[model samples]
Target: MTAKPARDPRDYSWLPADIQAFIARTEAAYPADAVTFSIQQQRAFYDRLCADFDPPHPPGVTTEDLTLAGVPCRRYTPTAPRSGVTAIYFHGGGFVVGGLHSHDAICAELAEGAQVVLIAVDYRLAPEHTHPAAYDDCAAVVDSVPGAKVLIGDSAGGTLAAAVSATRGETAQIAGQVLIYAALGGDPSLPSYTRHAFAPMLTRADVEFYGTVRYAGGVAPVGDVTATPLAADSYEGLPPTAIFSAEADPIASDSVEYAARLAEAGVPVEMTEEPGLVHGYLRARHMSEGARASFRRITSALAALAAQAVAQ
Candidate 1:
C-alpha cells in the first residue's frame, strides 16, 4: 500500500485561548490514535474523557434513573415548578458509545439552565444493536414523556431527536427541537463534508464508520423519515427548530441543509454556526468561551420552547 500522507498539525490559534487549553488537556487524556482501537476501548476512553470535564451537577436539580416504556432513562427535575413541558435528550456517541451516565452532567446543566424537566435516554448502542433499535428506544421514551415537549440531541442523539420529531404521527406533541452539532444525514459530497473531511475531533472517515455501524445490516430506504430526516418528503408542520453547527465539523452541512429544508417548508427555524469550534465541544461549555456561548444559546432556545408549550 502507498504510504499515508503526514497529517498537518491542526491550527487552534483561531480558537479562544481557554478552548485551546481545553483541547490540549483532552488530547493528553484521550489521544487521537485511540480511534484505531476497538469499540470497547473507544467507549472507555470516551467515558473517561467526558468525566474529566464533567462539572458538578447544578444545585437544586434532582435526578432519578428509571425505565420509561421499556427504555432505560435518567430524568433531571429542577426544584422550580415545571413549565408543563419536557425536554427529551439523546446523548451523542455516534450511536455506539455514550449512554445516560456519559451525558449525566450535560442533562443536569441543561435542566437547570432551561428550568425544565429533562429526560436523558440510554438507548442501545451499535455493533450489537443496530439501526431501528436505538431509534425505537428513543421514540418510545419520547412518546412516554407527559405533556408537550421539545427534543434535544447532539451528534447521533441529534439524529435521533430529528428523526423522532419528523416521523412521529399526528398525535405526538413536539413543541420544538434543539439540535446541537447534530448529524443529520445528507449528501456526502456537500461542501462542508469535503472541506472538513479531516477536521479535528470528528472526521468524515469517523462519521462514515459510525454510519456503517449504525446500519450494519443495510442502509435505510431513501425516503425513510425516521432513518434520514433530511430525506423526508416534507418538513412542513414539524416544529420550531434551533440548529447549532460547529464551523469545522464534517457533518456541519447536515444541520445547514436540514434548517434550510425546514425553512422552505414554512417551519420556524434558526441556525447558528459557532466559529473556531469542533465537534464534541459541548463538554467544554464550562471552560471554552465559544462552547459557553453555544450552551447559552441552547438554554435560551429550550427556555423559549418550554414557554411556548406552556402558552399553548
Candidate 2:
C-alpha cells in the first residue's frame, strides 16, 4: 500500500499571510472531532473564520435564492455570457455540518472563476435530515436547473455531488463534474486508507463516525456501488470528471480508485494529488497554501470547461 505522488507543499507559498494566521487560529479552535461540536459552536467558529478571509468580489456574478421543487437553493451567476453552463455546488462537512454561509467564499470564487452560474444547495443535515435526504436535495436541484449543468462539491459534499450526477445517468443534462478531496467508499486495505489512516485532518474513524450519524435511522442500505459513486455500477455517459485529493489525507486513495473506475468506464477523468495537504483544505482556502492552490486549479478547470463550450 504505497502512497501516490502528489503536488509539492511549496506550491502554496503564494497564500496570503492573513490566511495563514487564520488557519493557525482555527486549528487551535477546532480539531478532528469538529462534527461532534454543537451546531451553534460550529457556526460561530465558521463565521469567525469567514471573517478572516479577504472578501474577493464575485466579479460578473449575481446571487439569488430560489426554490426548486420546494427545495431552497442559493445561485451565483457569473456576469459573463455563455451557453447556459451552470454548476450546482455542495459544501463538504461530513453531512452533519456546513451550509450556505460555511462555503460561501468557495462558491463565490468558483462561480466567478469558472464563469458559470454556481448554485449552492443547502441540503438538510444529518441526525435530523439523515441519509438520502442530503443527496436527494442536491439531485433535485440538478434536475431542476435550467440548461446544461456541472456538479461540484468538496469532501462529503463531493460524495453527494458525484452520487447525484451518477444517479441521474447520461441523459440528465449534466455537462461535467469536479470533486475535491471527496470521501468515496473503498476497501480499507487501499494504500492511502492504511498508510495515511490518521492523516492530520480526516481519518478512518472520522469517516465511520460521519456514516454512522448519517444513516442512523435509515434501512442502513448496504454500501452499494451507486451509493459510493467511485464504486458505481456504471459511469458511462456521465460526463468528464476532475477529482482532487491531498497526499496527507486518508481518503485520497478512495478518489484515486474512483477515477480509475471512471477511466475504465471510458469516462474522461483527471485526478490531481496535492502533497502535504490534509482533508478539508478547500474550506481552509484562506490559510493553507495547498488549499489556495487547489482553488486555483478549480477555477482553471471550470474556465477550461467554459472555453470548450465556446469551441463547440
Candidate 3:
C-alpha cells in the first residue's frame, strides 16, 4: 500500500529493483512509525534495523574504543594506514537515535577503503543533550585527531561534518570533507524534498520531526551555522568537499545546493548523486549494486582526499 501523499505524488517506479527490494526489506524489519514511539522504543527498533543489515567488519581491520575529550568514540585502523591523514566520521540518526554500534561496519570499511585511521564519534543525542552537545562532541573529537584530518558524516552527521569543515576553513590540517545523504538544512521546499517527500525509507514528516527535536525549543535555531550548515555566512575558507547524495532522498538537493555554494565561494567540491538510492543506503552497499557502486565512489574520494591529491 502506497502512502497517501501529503504533498505531491511520489514515484518509486524510477528506483532500481534492488533498491526497491532494500526498501521493502527495511520496511518489513522496521516500523514506519518507529520515530513516533517513545525514545527507548525508537532506539530498540533502530538497533534491530541496523543489526539486520550489519556486515561483518572488513578483514584485517581493527577497532579500539575510547573516550575522546569526554565523548565516546570508536577508532578503526586498517592494516595499512595513511601517513598523516585521519578521517573522522559522525553517524546519522536524525539527532536522536544511533550510536557507535549503528554505523560500525560502514566506518570499518571507510577506514580500510581510505587506508587511514577513521574515528566514529558517538555524539550525544537530542531531547536531552540537544544542539551544541552533538556539535561540541564532534568538534572535540576533531581536535583530538593529530595531523591532517578529513571530516566525513552521513545524514545528521553530514551536517555536523560540514559544520566542522566550515569552521576549520582552508586550513593546513583540514584536508577534505565528505557528506553522505546529509540534510544540510536545505530549504524544505527544494525540488528533491517535494519529489521524494514520500519516497521509501524517509519522508518529509520525518525530516520535520528531527528538526523539531534537534534544538531545545522544538525547532531549528533561526541562524545557527552549526545547527544548519546552509545558514553559514559564507562558504569561503572551507576545505575541499565531496558530497554524495541519494537520488530518491528528500535531502538530495541539500548536497546540490551546498556543492554549488562551495564552488561559488572558491572551494573545491564534488557532488555525486547516487541514482536509485534512498537515505540510509550505506547499509545496502552489499545488498544493492547501485549502493555498492556509490560506496566504491565514496571510498575512492576518501582515498583521494587522504592523499591530498584532490584537484584544488
Candidate 4:
C-alpha cells in the first residue's frame, strides 16, 4: 500500500481547531480585504475588530493618560506596584492603526501581573508620520523615564521595542524587552514568508504594505538602527530579551533570527514559538489555549524583567 502523503503545513487544516475558531471570529468582524480599503476605513475596521474581543482589564489596575516628552501615553499602575521599574508597551496595528485604547486591557493585565507601572505608547502612525517619527516618539518616552525600563511591544511595536533596546538601552538602563511576534528586520524571502504568506490575520503582502507606509516616500532610511533594529551593525549591549512568536505567521522567522543574533552578541535572550498560531494572536488570548499560554509567558517575562531592574 502507498504511504499517505505528508500534510502541507500551509493549509488551514494544520491549524488547531481553537485557532481556526479564533480566525473565523476575528475575520468575521474584520473585513478580509480590509487592507485594500482606504487607511481611514481600514482603521475603523480594525477598531471594531479589536472591540469585539474586549475582555475586562485586570482588577485593581489604575490608569491615566498623559503626555511624556510630548508623546501621548497611557500609564497603568497595579494595586501593588513595584518601585524602581517600569514597562513601556507599544501596541501593534502595523504601525498605522493601534493606539492606547486599542491595547488598554492588555496593558492593565500586564501591569497587574508584573506588579509594576506599564506605560502604553500612542505613537504616530504612517502616511502621516513615517519611520523614524514613531521611533522618535517611542524613544522620547523612554528618555522621559528617570531610570532603566522594560521595553515591550507586539508586531510593529515589537520592532520599536527592539529599536529602543538598541538605541536607548544603555542610556535608559533598559532592564529587558519582551517582543510578541515582532517583525524584526528578517529576510522576506525566507521559508516562513513563502509557507505562511497567506496565513490567518496577517499576510506577507500586508507586511510589505506596512513597510511601505512606514518609510518616507516608500523608501527606507539607509543604516538607520532606530528604524530597524536588525539593520544595526551591532546587536551588542542590548538588554535581556524574551520573544514570543506564532509558528504559523509569516514573520515567525524574524523572531528566530533576532534571538540568534542577540545570543551571538552575548545578550541573554529567550525565544518561544507557539505552534499552530498565527500573527496577532495576542487578541485571541481569551479564545485560544495557545494564545492564552503565550500571553501568560509574556506577563511572566515582564514580571521577571521588572524584578531584574529592582535587583540592580
Return the top candidate by TM-score.
4
Taken over the whole model, the C-alpha lDDT of each candidate is: 0.86, 0.74, 0.88, 0.88
Lowest-scoring 10 consecutive residues by lDDT in candidate 4? 6-15
Ten residues in sequence with the least summed lDDT for candidate 2: 7-16
lDDT of 4 by residue, 23-119 (tens): 8998888876788999998888888987888788887888898999999999999999989988999989888897987888888988998898999
TM-score, one value per model: 0.94, 0.86, 0.94, 0.96
In candidate 3, where is summed lDDT lowest over 10 consecutive residues? Answer: 5-14
Give the number of the best model, judged by lDDT. Answer: 4
> Candidates ranked by TM-score, best first?
4, 3, 1, 2
lDDT for each residue of candidate 1 in 23-115, tens digit (9 for 90 to 100): 788877676666678988988888888889787898889999899999999989987846678999999988889888788998999899889
CA deviation > 4 Å runs, candidate 1: 1-13, 218-220
lDDT of 1 at 253: 95
The reply for model 3, stretches above 4 Å from the true place, is 1-8, 170-172, 309-312
RMSD of each: 4.2, 4.8, 3.6, 1.4
Per-residue error at 93 for model 2, in Å?
Answer: 0.5
Residue 234 of candidate 2: its Cα lDDT?
68
Alpha-carbon error at 49 in model 1, in Å? 1.0
